[model samples]
Target: MLWLYLHFPHLLLDHIRRTREETGALVIVEGSGQKVIQACPEARDQGVHGGMRLKTAISLVPELGTVRADQQQEARILEDQARWLYRYAAHIVLVPPDGLMAEIGSLQRLYGGLPAAWQTVEQALDERQLIAWPGLGHTPLAARLIARAGKGECTDDKGHIQRTLGQMPLLAAEFDARTCTRLQRLGLNTLGEVFALPAAELARRLSPETLARVQKIQGTRPDPQAPWQPPHHFRQQADFVQEIEQSQGLLFPLQRILAELEEDLCWRQQETDSLLLVLQHRHEEPSRLRIRTSGPEHRAEAFLNLVRLRFEQHPLRAPVMSLQLSVKRFLGREADTGQDLLGESQDLNEAWHTLMSRLQARLGDQALQQLSPQADHRPERAWTASGVQRNNRPAATMNDQLPRRPLWLLQGPQPLTEAPTAWFAGPERISGGWWDGQRVHRDYYIAQLHNGQLAWVFRDVRDGWFVHGWFG
Candidate 1:
């Protein structure tokens, strides 16, 4: 079986640095803050290196920034990476503190070849702004060792893998200190020298556990790994090294998260209509913002635009230390919107929904209302304002057989002093409201008055002719 290993040499340091907008010499120190464990390129250029005392490194570069390493945080970050890798490979093994191993033997055919599979992972890492060393091997242990030793290369040839594995020094084999020391004493400096010894002889020289490790690395023993699975819901966050007081400052990190979300949605072939954004603060309660779309949405630009509009409406009340975006609800994949011969959407439903979403974002949710026809027969109560609902079908048109109605209806019917000069359409009787206390009995007509104004006049059976509404 072929395996791909991803070794993150500076996972913690990279994770911490991505939050800042400025570049500077930075290092992640040990928990005790005595020595540097990881340093960025800027720090390395300034003569800062891992294993150097923190004070000495600071003396070399006075402005060097340091963040203490946290094992829990590192583990969380590793799991986050695993979540991302799961989309490409189904069988992923999470190696604590720095590495990941995935069995890509089954994926090679699906992804075309080893190069394409490797490129896919590399592209994901690059987009995530992660620094990873990828290595390929016949076994997981071999892959991890090669990646950690910085000798990673894309190759499925077992001969090449064995040759690369043999060249690695015994120190890079991940053997225990006592075994390594004993092997060094025995004049075995490289993995090839150790493997040259007979298995029986090596078993006699080393403990059963260490012997098994060598066997696994050599693909003689099984080293099965449990695959990592993603959770049902997506919750991603970005922590800032510097607190941002303005809402605009949150957009950059938010954009990164939204892009990842768009990729995830595409992978799942699903969409979402709601998103929850939580802005963490240092001393105040987190500000919560709920972003809703007029319809199921998957595009990152659309989400970002709506978020920009939301920020404009509701300014930040507190300085944000970090931002968390989550989506728990997932909608089924929408049907493909048919395109015309030129490849543009033939239906205007999507465009209308987009317009409504933009309007909702700019104005309050309640600001926009849709007029829907009611079942009432009374002219005044024929239609009512209702919440907008996005649908593929166009609004129902008025039937030609139905009586003509005015576009502008008066608040109340007024008595007409003079009769109509001419009648365009007439004698449409309406009688309803028996269930309710207010009953109506009238004969409505479309007529033009003496002044040549078309009016919707009705003759109330109990009263006289009254002008009810006007036509545009």
Candidate 2:
């Protein structure tokens, strides 16, 4: 299998700065035991580094701005990119905040050749203003190392992978400075020298983990990767020659894209569950627009209508050059109820689409959200807001818990002056996320409050009482 590897050294901060259009100002996140989580290139240019003291970063940049790192936001962006890449290949593996590795061996035939496949991947990234150094090899680890080391076009044709990898400094594999220094001391500086050694001898000399790392890079061991799934059949596109400045200019292009998508869906014998619309601009980052039908739908007019509703309520920040519409998520084929005199299904779908489209055209993409259940049994952590196009359902465990959940839960738990509950149903306690050490052990309860409202409450063993949630 051909493994495609990517690495982004400053992915989190780069993504945050880009998406937020935050330039010149530096951002520092003091997360998980007050460690600096990310820093922008501009900040780095001024001598700020990840894990640097936030106070020191500010001292260096002076104008540094900061926000708590939102790993969820970064993860969502990665998920979207994975979905887009899925168009060109079957298996995509997420390497988290900064990387992705994909299996594209089977796609070589479909895209013509390895080079062409790389171009397709490049184009997808180009459309998103994302830069990736891509490398192909037999092992995921080898591909990742090559990509990180800037060997964009490297291939493992004649052990060139092993050779190229050998030439690379040990640090290229993300090994710690101590390990690299240790290897340098033994004249095993290059990965090739390490690879050339007898496995048992190397294991004896350094550590078994050292041998395992070499084995992974050499493809002697299986690298388990979590695969990404692409959405089912759907398509949408926008054509524009003249730049559209005003918000309303988006409508015609969106309608055109929806029309084409409708026709495409009809031909494919499919319906869409979630539609993702990307508005590519001439001078700025693309605006992401998305819409999810209440259920599976194939009616072109209805799809366009929902998007129109979203757009009409939301306005634009930049002029659109062209639009690309695609199904980010979907369900299987379904029978289309053509036209009816009652028009109940048709009218509702079309009306809903139109309303959503107008809202999206006017308000921008972040205006609308759908709710999803979360995995934690704690009612305060029971649900999350999701974008309509990416309607992620909650995990199975989320619904099976005995915790009486609230119909309405505050964004954060409300503190109570006194403790009311003596017995806890779930002294079912949790602790130790404390490596970053923001540990808490709460005695959670499903209790009846004085006002007759069923509340999900918790008492931190150290702190006092906090009303965590409510069950109406």
Candidate 3:
């Protein structure tokens, strides 16, 4: 099976630089913050290079920016890239700290050919603003070595792969310092010279571990790689080298992250109504913002707009150092039955949801309410106003022959000081609330008042008449 290995020389540096608008000198230092592990092109142009002492690097470029390396953060960034690559290949093995190996042999037919698959991955990397050296080989180890040596190619020829593997220096063979020194002392400089020696002689000269590594690279021994699967829920974080003092400064990074969420939801063929956004501060406690929609939505622009409204309503309490976005629950996407085949029809429900979401974000979650019909015979108890429902449920069926109710209703019955000038149609008896102890027995009618105003009048069993509501 053909394998594709990707080596990111400066994964951390690239990730940090992608969010910056300025092309300035930047370097990623070790945990101790004493030396540089990776440098960007701008830093290199300023005579800054990897392995340089941090003090010396800063001396060379006074404005040089440094971000300390984090094992957990690096792992998260690598996993994020792997999740993107998973779209092109199913079997992917993450070589932590800087590499990814994918088995693309089985995908040749699905992608049309090897070259097309190679180009697809390349384009995906470009779109994500990442840099990777990719290599193709018959074995995972072989592809990894070539990629690490900056000699990756797109060819799938077995002979060419072997020849490329043979030309690699012994240091690129992934051997320890002692083994490389021993091979050098034994007049072995390149992997090709070591391969020319007999297996027995090589085994006699090298330890069993080194010999096994050699056989693995040569494809004589099986190198089984455990496939990596993406997580079910989407959680991504964006860390900054410089503290962002303004809330507006966070949008640049949030745009890209929300777009990825859109893609993930689209891939799952689902939607989400809730998102949790956390803002880490320099001195203050982290702020947690829960942004919710009126209904299940998958559009990035819609989510971003809601977030913007939230930001306007609630300002940042402190300088943000990093931000994390997470979606814990997912909802199934329902088909848009309101539209036609040509998509010319406008979805009124979608528009209503958009408006409600905006108002909720600007005001508070508890500020808005939705009116729902209740199963009650009394007019006042027939409907209820409560929080908006996220999932759409089938509306209760109603008889078309039933008399219509007025939109405007009074708080309660009022004394009718004047008699009705005319009567429309009524005598619709609604008697219930017997179990609730608030029994009501009245005959309602639609009548016009003497002041030329339409009103709803009702009379009780004692013949006492009153105006209960009005007809708009």
Write down the worst ten-residue block by lDDT for model 3.
340-349
lDDT by residue for model 1 (1-472), tens: 8999999999988886786778998999999999999999999998999999999999999998888888987887898898889999999999998999899999989999989999999998998889999999888999999999999888888888888999999989989999999999998899988877888888887887878988999999998887787888777777776678888888988888898899889989999988999999989999989898888888899999999999999999988877989999999976785974455573575677788888888897899898876778898788888768854465467666555578888889999889889998878999988889788999998999999899999999887899999997
lDDT (Cα, tens digit) per residue for candidate 2, span 1-472: 8899877665555444443322575564755526566666677788887888777777787777675655765675566566556666778888887788889888888888888888888886775556677887788888888888888573548477767888887667776677678888987667777778899988898888878888988889777887876545444343343456776666665654576566556655676767888887877888886676656777777776677676666577688765667774545674547654444465565556555645555565578887877665445445787755522244457445454455777677788755454443655465543454455678777776655666677778776777777766
> Which candidate's lDDT is highest?
3
Worst 10 residues of 1 by lDDT: 340-349
- Could you tell which candidate, 1 or 2, scores higher by TM-score? 1
Q: How does each model score on TM-score?
A: 0.76, 0.52, 0.83
Clash counts per candidate, in order, are: 0, 38, 0
lDDT of each: 0.88, 0.68, 0.89
Between prediction 1 and prediction 3, which has the larger lDDT? 3
- How well does model 3 score by local distance difference test? 0.89
lDDT of 2 at 318: 82
Q: TM-score-based ranking, best first?
A: 3, 1, 2
